[model samples]
Target: MFDKYLIDVATLRNTGPADAPTGFAFEAKLGYYRGLGLSMIEKLDVSIDGEQLPREAVRFDEGNGPLSLDEMETAYDRRWPFGTPATILIERPGGFPPGEHELSLLQQLRVSYLPFPSTNSDAKSVSFPG
Candidate 1:
């Protein structure tokens, strides 16, 4: 099965005093059956302003076991701890220009006994006035 996830740009942080990179973050929820021992098996695909961005996957253990199903929320906000939002650097190829941008997340999962089930939220787009 396949699933699609969208990130909200409003939640991204862009203002701060320290030099930091600009990027978006968000939480993903996964549900699994008992003894399936299924886990997230890949990194997230990130895209900004219609362009693909390089991203590092940060995984957190929610403590839910193989027999349990629950929802997990992750931070999807982007910000620069030291520099202005405009000056913040992005590791992805050809960073976005000063204007409206759209960010998205894509991932694949593995299940032991059952077919993978997937779902997605609506895509979100935001504008940054130059």
Candidate 2:
């Protein structure tokens, strides 16, 4: 989440082979807010099917390098904002089976006027039942 805003997942897709560099392309947005500054994300954690993906696997479409969960700051300019229609790419070496899975994202956010950072985490599972 970005401050009080929620980065929600609208769509999830597996566009690669199961054994290849496979992962989900999630289309997300900052709920209720128009947008957020680029540096607002202090740390981000991603997990698929309960397996935590490395920090190097997550990439924002507008950023040059991958995001680090331990990093204290962003490398891009603050002018670039993130909001709805943002596509986030998360890749793993060996992908999940062709079935239901749980996808979750925990984000530590930074606010300009706040004395301390905020925590915004969300989790949702994808289930297809017969």
Candidate 3:
């Protein structure tokens, strides 16, 4: 229901040094009104310019440090606070070539009281930092 706000399109950028970028990154917000532990996030599917990214190619970070998607499954110690954006990283050797690219994310978040996880989808055309 709150999928449109899942990604902060304005914060898209290449991560690591510009010349040797390790990947691209962008700020992401939770669809839920309140925050939950990283473990609550069940699935995160990302695609760039129409290509689906491998599960191993994406990472999540909340500023303190970066964690693999698998690691996040057990990251009970990590809290994604409400209204705060988390960084989503995609591993791409050169990142985007300074152009606008279609970025999309589909996430399944588990709400403890619900029988099924909440699914959120967001897509946008964002420019890489020049």
Best by TM-score: 3
Report lDDT (CA) for all predictions. Answer: 0.35, 0.57, 0.86
| Candidate 3: tens digits of C-alpha lDDT, residues 1-130 | 6788888888888878967988888899888888989999888888988888899998998877999989999999998887788999999888755777888999888999989888888998876655
Worst 10 residues of 2 by lDDT: 63-72
TM-score of 1: 0.43
TM-score ranking from best to worst? Answer: 3, 2, 1
TM of each candidate vs. truth: 0.43, 0.67, 0.89
Pick by lDDT: 1 or 2, better one: 2
Deviation in Å, model 2, residue 124 alpha carbon? 1.0
lDDT tens per residue, model 2, 1-130: 2533333444666547644636666655443233455567766677877777888777665344444433325554532344645556777544434457676776666667779976666677666221
Could you give candidate 1's per-residue lDDT for residues 4-121 as a string of tens digits?
A: 3234354444432224423323333332222222233333345565655544323222233111112112222221121111111233222233576675555343434437643233
Using TM-score as the yardstick, the better of models 1 and 2 is 2
Deviation from native of the Cα of residue 95 in model 1, angstroms: 8.3
Q: Among all windows of ten consecutive residues in candidate 3, which has the lowest summed lDDT?
A: 92-101
